[model samples]
Target: MHNDCAECPADSPDDKVFAVFWETQSNCQNLVGNPHTRFLTHIMWSFVEPGEDGTVPSEFQYWSQEHIKDCILQLRMYEICIHDVYTLKCDVVVVVAYVRFGFDGIDIDDETGNMKGTHQDWLTHHGPVVVNYLQALRDGLDAIQRPDEPRYLLTWDEFPSAWDPPDPTNEHYTGCISFHEDYDGWHRCYEPRISALVDMVNVMFYNIDSGDWVYELVLKDTLPVKAAAVIPKNKIVVGACSGQGCVSDQPIGQEVYNAGNGSAFYRGSNVR
Candidate 1:
């Protein structure tokens, strides 16, 4: 979702997303007097590092479960649903607390892709086992449905399509490393199959200058992956950033919207 930055150019009328990332270390007090508070639809809670044993270690220094509950209750005033996603590691056990804490969804973000062990391990071995983990997480979220409440979301912080190297001969030039031509392992992690399992593949764009570069990255790299039908265009959400890690050289939210053919723009900036 777009923020109320005057220096940042506005998004198109059709681009209707105003999401933000809320760091777990921050408290609800920070939301007070926030100008962009009125426009947010989603707020993803950041960095719940999980262990390989499928549990969030109590030793971790982020907010306690009760604190998260209080924060969620306070955030409801703005009508924004919180995606309490775990970062660094993936754990299915913590999915049970999703409804208990009034969470709207689960976002799995393991940048190293080493949830199972080793980089790219989960994606590479996402077969029936990984599928079952996703299914179990989905089922846990769905089992608590109340008809009146919005459906729970299951999204992944996916590798950006533009992350592929520039050289034509590079093996990873195709963007989706799981679907690379030379690969001979399991292919269930292939885009289309995994896309069906989650609500959205939230592309994580990091350290890139905003404006035309963001647009061109989506247009040239991201769209091509969709064109190949690896990942559905509709299921993709182009991530825009404007925080410490991101380089907001210029604002071009509308360019990202246009480049993605009017797909939702997920503002993944660390605006806390």
Candidate 2:
């Protein structure tokens, strides 16, 4: 006698699992339209086993060890694709690690033998390989540069908190730092060690729940102001979110005094 499992099926059906492709295009008809700016493309990859009803699997459940490895391998391949696109278009390539939960260990029978651990551990184990690959890609571009053109590598989410210097002799070879308000805690956590290694700090100012209030009260009035008084301003780069659903009415430059119904005032330029 065989018992049927409510979740897992004996064999995944071909019709049940399929990949979908999507593309977005915008018409540049106004001053806001800039052809030079490339759309920051985000490619999210995930693995799913087919369900009994022939639908894609949900993200709520834990993925198996093999599944996790396969996903990472796919992401590595996707990174190569990004390199190819970047080489052709001169557009920025940002590889985002969208995995939300833990990952299984590659060495399942290692000395410690603990299978369940945070994704960071797996990332730590495999990060060097990915970084080296990126470095080689960057070097290839640099070899053919016309001196007037500039290129850069941008990565997010999957960026590791700690790693050995890519080049021990070259301090500038240390990775760049990009920040998100959501990951402010991670920033603080890695600040002591990685701060020295960082070349530029890309401060993500978008998606903040509270606009000028948080920027003024939390960041400018508090952390950044204090940090600036102690550190260097050249280290930071402020960014804004101009995508749909983002509030564009908020003042950016010295005019931010008009942010909160002409009450609260910010006395600085947007860039600084």
Best by TM-score: 1
Across 1-272, the per-residue lDDT of candidate 2 in tens digits comes to 01211332232111111111111222212211322112212222222333434343333134343443343354333231111111011112222121222221000001110012212232343334334534444454345444653333222211122222233355443321222332332221122322232323333343344456655653444334543442244433333333342334443542333122111222111111
In model 1, residue pairs whose N, Cα or C atoms come closer than 3 Å (at least 3 residues apart or on different chains), thus clashing, are 1-17, 1-18, 1-19, 1-267
- TM-scores for all candidates: the values are 0.66, 0.32
Predicted structure 1: lDDT: 0.51
Q: After superposition, how far is residue 53 of candidate 1 from its true place, in Å?
A: 1.4
Quick one: how many clashes does candidate 1 have?
4
Best by lDDT: 1
lDDT by residue (159-209, candidate 1, tens digit) is: 454334334356533233443333432212233456677766666554344
**Model 2 lDDT, residue 94, Cα:** 21
